[model samples]
Target: MDSAVDGLVSQAARGLHLRVAQLISEVEQRLRCEVPALWEYPDARTSEYIAEHIGTILNGLEDGTRLGAIDPPAPEPGRTGQLAQYGIPVGAVLRAFRLGQGVILDRMLEEIPRRTNDPELVGAAARKLIEGANAYVDRISERGVVAFQEERDRRMQRRLSMVQEAGVRIGTTLDITRTAQELADLAAEYFADIVTVDLLDSELRRDGAPAEDPLLLRRVARRSVSEEPSASVAPQQLHTYPKGARPYRALITGQPSLHLLDMPDEPVRGSIPESEAGALRVHSMLVVPLSARGATLGVAQFFRCGASLQFNDDDLLLAQEIAARAAVAVDNARRYTHARATALALQRSLLPRRVPPQSAVDVACRYLPAGARSGVGGDWYDVIPLSGARVALVVGDVVGHGIRAAATMGRLRTAVRTLADIDLPPDELLTRLDDVVLRLSAEASIDTDGEAVEDAGTEGDIGATCLYAVYDPISHRCTLARAGHVLPSVVTRDGTVDLLDLPAGPPLGLGGLPFEAAEVELPEGSLLALYTDGLLEARDHDIDAGVARLRDALARPAASLDATCETVLDAMLPERPDDDVALLLARTRALGARQVATWDLNAEPAAVAGARSNVSEQLSIWGLEEFGFTAELVVSELVTNAIRYGRPPIRLRLIHDRTLMCEVSDASSTTPHQRRARVFEEGGRGLLLVAQLTRHWGTRHARRGKTVWAELGESVAFPQLALALPGWDSG
Candidate 1:
């Protein structure tokens, strides 16, 4: 190109650089009108950026650089990226740059005509100046567009990452509080400066749908970037929002909304305290309803505090999506909590309320339900008073969890008590219980009409384990039998603990397996520990370790059976057991020779007189003289029937404990039944009269013999004994 045109263009560019401040002012004014988006930016920032671009262009022109070789300014790309981050359109940025270039190019072209009189030189300089300015704008605009696109892509990627992170982080557990806190923490990290999760009080309690208009909410969780306590509400605080409030409106409509707190008409000021409203006036808030499965569970509030960008449509949609997932999780946790609570209530109701008072053993028991996740299982313990100064210690566990297991446990416990009333041996009793379980399992497989259900899964296939033990103080022996249950531990009076060497029978419900009973002769004050397997298979330890711990605990000297029970549980169980646990501890008490009297008699009609004489003497000695007539009549009738209808040897025994007890043992397995006698009949009145004269009368059949026993009333108190046998009447 000609030096004259280049020199004139360079001189004009130099003169314009000297007037750069005025040029920048003119560019800023023109941009405010031509590119309205730049008005959102600060006036000083706009002026400074324009001045930088103009100065760079003029410096290149003054250095005699070629028109096509002018480079874009250093700050142009970064400035465009900042504008894109603030959500400004790229078109507006380029338009503002184009308009600023027009002002600079117009000034340089107008100055060139005055510096040179030659028409060709003036025209050439003006053309070169206009071409360089256009090249500069084109290059800078390209850089700005690239930066804007890159910023937009980065923002989109960050938002996608946040959504993916939310999917993984929230709802990680079946706990409502934990899930709520996760939602709050995630939102506070990615979307907002302050996040609060507020659930409807009714939803939290699983108490059906929420009320209309004004809603009562409990703040389950809250998180803030500043980590300071909220001025409006604290965590777990229950507060009510009026009808027009943002949270209330969002829940009522089941829609998400964005609100600018600086708006004078915003209703947030009515819901929060004046101090908090003042502090929040400069921020933006988003209220998203937590709706799932057609029900609105609660609302999540996200606040952009201080200089943070205001919440937009995209932020509202993202918050709504996150709240939707969290709502489902909260609902699941609420349902689980309700189910566990119901199962626990049913289990506690089915268990024994209080141990009965018996002469055989001093018993104490403990029952614990499973942890939160496992729900309530079916573990039960009971101390039932049996006939003839004996007591039954029962601990059983049903498979599965929730209401079905608890109900089945109740039925099994009832079956046990019913079978025990007949004075069945432990092995025979378990056999009967096994049959009952088999019947239950069969019934579960079929419907009421007896048709087999095709979809009946293992839900109805009932399975359980039980340990039944009957201890007799008179014999000082404990007969124990198990149906797929853990062995019972016996702690001797000398603090020696050993698990009973009982046969391991198949668990109940698996029919056709015979259970065997093991007899352990326990001395007076010996401790018998019967428990469900849960005690030996807790979460933290294996069965072997649990057994060792249990043995060690039982071997330690304790003040009483109650203390021993507590000690055993504390040693064996963790804070939150994975399964239900039931422990029964019984200390044996023997009836000494003074508390009982016995005699053998001939199997003849005259034996009745000897039995009556012996019983009267025993009652008199035991200070139960008031019951002498009743005892004499009961003994006479029982002995007479045994000699008349029973075969072979017969013996009579009188227990002076609790109440006056008359017992007749015969070497016959035939059980006597009570019948109403005809008015004119002289025979068959023996057993009927015995039943009428005693408080309770029953016949317990043994392998080789049967005992017909009768107990007198408790109206006459014995000095040293308290005997109240169960009412297991054969009649």
Candidate 2:
């Protein structure tokens, strides 16, 4: 080699070294820190572009350099080969280089070409280039590693703060959406962007839509991160998205759908957003799919650039951690919502509708459900209209509580309506009801789990206490019967009184016990109180005490019947609302402000005509019209029964209260019972048909022989309509 050529080569090499040194210094200045060992741009872009930038900085530095021959700064600072600082992150600063796999290809392109250069320098230079490239890569990788570690530290700290905040802000589990939002805000703060969480589904909610499931709102809350995320739903705006009906693209597809869109630069929509904000404008972005169990809550998207660059992987990972925290919060909210809706539905289902508007009588009623919850029980009341211008009042209870209890209540309601359609008196209706109860009991041990009492007496013993009564406008007679139900309280213009009908029979479904309807003349302007046991059963008082309290409240002056009932219940059953209660107040006022008379009698057939005349006279005296026809029919049935099956000197008595009552005295101790009328038999049909025609008729023993009686309801509107000729004085 010539001296001149060697000198020229040496000088050229020195100049190149000086240029690289100046370039490195310029890059460090631009980065606002040391370039951290060696650095290179991704290779997908022209290496020429990188060289150009490097050359520009280098030439400018060289133009101002005092030493053009100095060896380039010892081939980048030499300390530990890889980055060791935990606080500074590697990926944080080098994030853009990795996006879309640019960094991967960059490393490949940068190494292969340089390693392949030359024959004389082949092995030695190849090894040297490889080692040098490794060193450079190590430095670049260290920066990213530092950045990632720093991000991890920040995320952990944020999570700890969020947990502490959750403990302070929402101490317990209550309210849906409220605590969720609070936790959501905390998540947003932790990740410093849009953080969302959607919880999983459990037994109640099969899907995400509120309409698809009654209990779907339960189990929506924050979940831990150790669990894999599921598809979730999140409204882009305020409109809460239920979830995806098809194959969800997010972390979840069921209720509370969401995804972990943690990185600010990583648009959940997949593209580097091409909106007003450019894709590359991102400083950092994070995304995490919030999920729990198998449910996919929703996605959480975070954004991080003020005026800088795309978000890094560390940021995205942090967003995911934040979403995990939100999952727990959402669960609480959904559970609270489910509980509240269930309570409301149960209460509404067990109440009666508004009172029907009518002229025969003004009716108004109200039912206030017990505030406490014990599963769900059934207690119901009804005002059923019957044939022949009559109305029936009934109230009953099923024995258990909760959803099952409510279902039983529905069944009982259907049964009561069916019985009402037949228009049977309380007793006969009860007999049929017993059959129904027997059938139901045979099917299962527990009736319907609420107020539907379990039939424990035997196979045919399904039981419920009820009070059935009929009211007639013409007679102003309220015929009421008690089936092991509470005695009713009557408030008269004269004073308050307990109209305890002694003929009350056993509850329905109990050994087929019979029921007897008891009649009382509701003198004009009378108030009758009918109520369920819940009204009479309280924490501190027995049913008897409750009844007494009701009576006392009714006695108070200057109070309407409905008002009195309400007041009494309010005063007595105000606290500890654990039982079901129902109350119906009927005010039967004879519009005419009329007067009437009543009498007693003994069973006797010989007194038939006289009893009829007595009843007729009584009706005339009371200013009631056209009683002769009804009187004849009433006497015939009463006298016939007395003579054929009754015994003794019969005394006849008449009643002018509402119906024309014909009574006969007799010595016969056996009370009359009605058998099904036969087509061939002549006599049994008499009493049977008689009992069916009138609202009510019965026998009661006093001092002497028992009395057989019949009541012929006065048809006030059509007085001339016979429908029946003079009975020829009947039997």
Candidate 3:
């Protein structure tokens, strides 16, 4: 601390300034080669400038200037900004300056032996050199430290801004996979060279508890900063983490982990997948648990690979913040997924498992709900078998979506079947359905949310649209009526498509309006496509365009009704339909003359005897001798009743398809009801005998009057009729 000694040291430093500068320059040049930031500067001029700055500092030391006043300039004008731009940490800059000091001292030590053989001069000169180097290094480092702190503060501000942006950007939608991927993408953009997001199985399970094992985590999202093509696809997503893996450990501990791969002291080797571990040459990794509400839902891993800086405490904090926000979004999505699954199951249970087989129509159907945004809706189709080889093909749509709409759709379907069984015409059936809907809308309090509508007539209406059509193989005609439903497309036998010219009646539930029915003569082998409005109405196209698209798809019929149904859906339904779609396609097949037998009977009791004889003969010829006795008995009883209590113009007909159909028509409009006759009753037992002798029998009132029909199964093995066939069949 002697002033004279300091002055002597300063003079020696000035005289030796050039030697010190040369020695320091040599050391700096070597160190810059290893330091990333220094290597980025313009070639030899950078070294020369550094050397001159050192010489100026040595001259200041000789002149006895204060350490603060003597500034060692040389890292160019904006060293702080330059180092930061090159991603060089302030520590690296300070290390380079420290290396220059060692070189100056080492050069002075070598000069001590050559300066003189006198010990005093050698010792004094060496002390001055060491003191000067220490003072200069101390002063310059202070400046570097200040600059470094400033640069670090700026970086911290920028990272905070990025974190705020990520909060707003990530999990913007309630989708589990998307939100996870967003976290990975954001991390890869700013903090990491590679990112992966793995979620716990419990967070994805419908029960909200892990299936089989709760500790298993499934990788849901992954990303890499490099765009280089790799031989292997990224396994960051859709891969499982072992129970004891690093990600799993992070989840269990609910803590962030930082591992520097190059450090032997860090104990995280063999922690990740082998392939991923091998890919890390000079990398640092940080793993943080995506935890929320005290539950660890998943973990996020960020890797700084290649030349990127190692993972530090600040980086870990940012990653944990991102993972925290992402965890909440993922949890929300998981809950929504469970709700969606429940809704889908309800919809499936309400939908028909398979279309009922009909003798008149070969049917195929398809129903698809709208995308995730809409969840499940009330689009439905059904094939109900009407009496006499006629089938009612129906497609309906409820006004709303989700479980409520589906429940409403099921109710409407049941109502249609109930009305259809009564043998009402298509138009009349819809009229009654509208009444049912109006009542449903009024009684809306019942919340018939999940009742499988066995009797829709009793339930209140949810708003809906329906297109009901009845196809008769005998007449080769289909009678269709609509209530605010889309028109159907009919593909003729010649493969020509035409939209059915039917009136668009008001949708169901809106009462006071009458629905009209239109009949089209479908030729044999013709195709009939009935669909709900969802098929013909979408955001991209109006009903007209949709019909046109459908017409084009069905222009040339496919090989089978199933194929045609698929083709129509593939063409008419958009990739992501905006609404639920229900389609029903049927191919018409007429009953040939060989399949039907008809007869006209006189309006007299004696005519019954002749009708029985004719039915017996036809059954024998058609190889239905097993049912000949039953047929004769049915014909006798039907004819006698038509003649005894009915008007004139009586007729009998028999259809042999899957079953034997015996129909008797008369001019009387009275409907026959089956009643339990007293043990002594004779005449009332006629209808009762017909009912017991056949599988089913019903009376349908026609335009002219009425037709009482009975259908018997193929095999009738019971004893002969006890009534002896109304005194006509002694044969």
Candidate 4:
């Protein structure tokens, strides 16, 4: 090129640089007309890019160097990459560059003819400017295309990775709220700036079908990338969207819908709160239905905020795919929650409503079910009032969870109460309960014809662990036995806490295993704690640590038994326990010598009259003159029976407690039978008459002898004689 042509090109380049702002404006206008997609960007942003392009061209012309020889601007590739991320097509970007190039070429060629009158020089400058402009446009266009493709591939990979992560992260637990939270967190981290998961209220509660017309939704989870809390709905909040709302429409149609909040036609004020709408005015939102197995479970909302790219068709599709995966998890959690709720209801119903009133101990108990993932397990505690003013404190835990475990627990509890009614020792009662469990396991395994069914070995095998303790206030002793259960703890009156030393028998359902009982004489006001293994194995499964913590908790002085129970739970249990726990705490009470009277009588018929006289004298002394006649009659019959059929060393004892009790014991293991008196026989009516006179009558066998006992109702005697009787008042 000639120096004159070069000088001309240089002059035009300087002139174009001087008018850069005007050039940018003209190029932007042309781009708006030719490449409408560029119009989506703000005017200032479009002008900034156009200014960079014009600057680069002018500098190359001033230096008189080839435009292709210089690298593009530092931000050129990134600018095009951003356009790709914003979902702009490469063709549209290349067209915008071409339009700006034409505008520059026209301005420079027009400036050449005005500056130089020579035809040769003007023609030479025009040709040079056109050549340089075309080279620059081609160079940047190639770079833009490469950048756009790379960005598109990178975004596609990210989306694919997010979908794969959703499979691993969501539905990790059988908890509806937790699953929803997992979905929201995953989406907010990768897919959107803000995400929310809302399910039908019925779906959350696992009740009824999804509502369509007026969608009743509960926000189960909400997540946002911003530090500031969203002005939208909160988690666990229940709200309803009207029929025409975007969320309602998506749920009704079972499809995803995208809304540009900045668009005038997409009014969001009526669909959402004004604050939320205002907050989202400059963003785009995607509402995707969480549908699984042909059922619409819920809806997920994704919001692009600040400078983030607006959601487009591909984004909506991705949101739908992610929501589809999450929907299956949510549905599974909903179904599992329904089953867990049913099992929990059954377990609670089968448990004791309230501890029965008894004078042996002041008791308080607590039962906690396992975490949602584990389902509801079988854990039960009962305070059964046995004969002789004694009470049984029992806690049992079945091996598995759900309805079967709960049912088995109920059956075992019933069996314990029945065995207790017979006044069996703790060891003997557990032995009987073990037999009951074995029978139950056997029955569960067999089919209708009494033949064993396939796959009935482990699934149908019933197993449990129980701790049964019988506390007698009269003797101030507690006899406790266990079938593979944690040892019971005792807090002595001196504030020392220790676990009782007892044999750890095999778990129930293991036939032929002998259970042993340990008898500990508890002082008045001593605390006894009976609990299942769950209480000791919940945290790290370190039973020693749990026992130490429990011992320390029990050692603390509490105002009441209920407070002690709370303290023990707070100390021994984690925020969420992994297993079922049943705790029973009892404070011992003693019946003083003044409340009981005993006599040793020989095995003679004459001892019956003396027994009757002695009972009358004791009743008068205890201010129970009102019950003299009934007591005398019951004592007469029991003593006569013991004298006739029993061995030597017969004994009679009377107890003044909640009820008046008379017991006659002899060195005979034979039990008496209550038979009807025929018209021909006069000898069978003594036991029958004794049963008719007392409120309750039964016989309990001991190792050395059998005791026949009867209890008189206190309704007629206690209230009238409470003030007159010394040391006979009910505590």
Give candidate 3 misplaced runs (Cα > 4 Å): 1-59, 72-153, 160-179, 207-211, 225-246, 253-279, 291-296, 328-345, 439-461, 640-649, 667-670, 680-688, 719-731
Tens digit of per-residue lDDT, candidate 3, span 135-159 = 7777777776777777777877977
- Return the top candidate by TM-score: 1
Each model's C-alpha lDDT?
Answer: 0.81, 0.52, 0.76, 0.83
User: Cα deviation of 347 in candidate 3 (Å)?
Assistant: 3.6
Model 1 misplaced stretches (Cα beyond 4 Å): 1-73, 83-141, 208-213, 227-232, 263-282, 447-459, 538-541, 656-660, 676-695, 715-731
Clashes of each: 1, 99, 4, 0
Give each model a TM-score.
0.84, 0.50, 0.75, 0.79
Give per-residue CA lDDT, model 4, range 1-731, as digits (tens).
Answer: 57878888888787778888888888888888888876574422666777777787788878876554655678998899888776778888988888887888898888887787899889977877777677778888888888899999998998898889999999898888899899889888886877778898876665565454466788888876656665446667877877778888888888789886666224543324455545545378898999988888888888876666787777887888888989999999888888888889999998999888788999999988888767789899999987778888998999999888988888888899889888898999999999999899989998889888898888568999999998889988888899998888888889998889999899999889799998889989998999988888865759888888888899988899999999988988887788988999999998888999999997888878888889999999999998998789779988998888888789899989888999988889999998865665657767776666678899888768888999998644333432333332346
Spell out the clash pairs found in candidate 3: 10-62, 440-460, 440-461, 441-461
Error of model 1, residue 220, in angstroms: 1.6
Tens-digit lDDT track of model 1 for 668-729: 89888877656566676677666556678898888899998987777643322112212222
- In the range 462-491, model 2's lDDT, one tens digit per residue, is 467778888876577777777778887777
lDDT of 3 at 411: 84
Q: Tell me, what's the RMSD of every candidate?
A: 5.6, 11.7, 7.9, 7.2
lDDT of 1: 0.81
* Candidate 2: residue 58 lDDT (0-100): 32
Can you list the residue pairs that collide in candidate 4? none
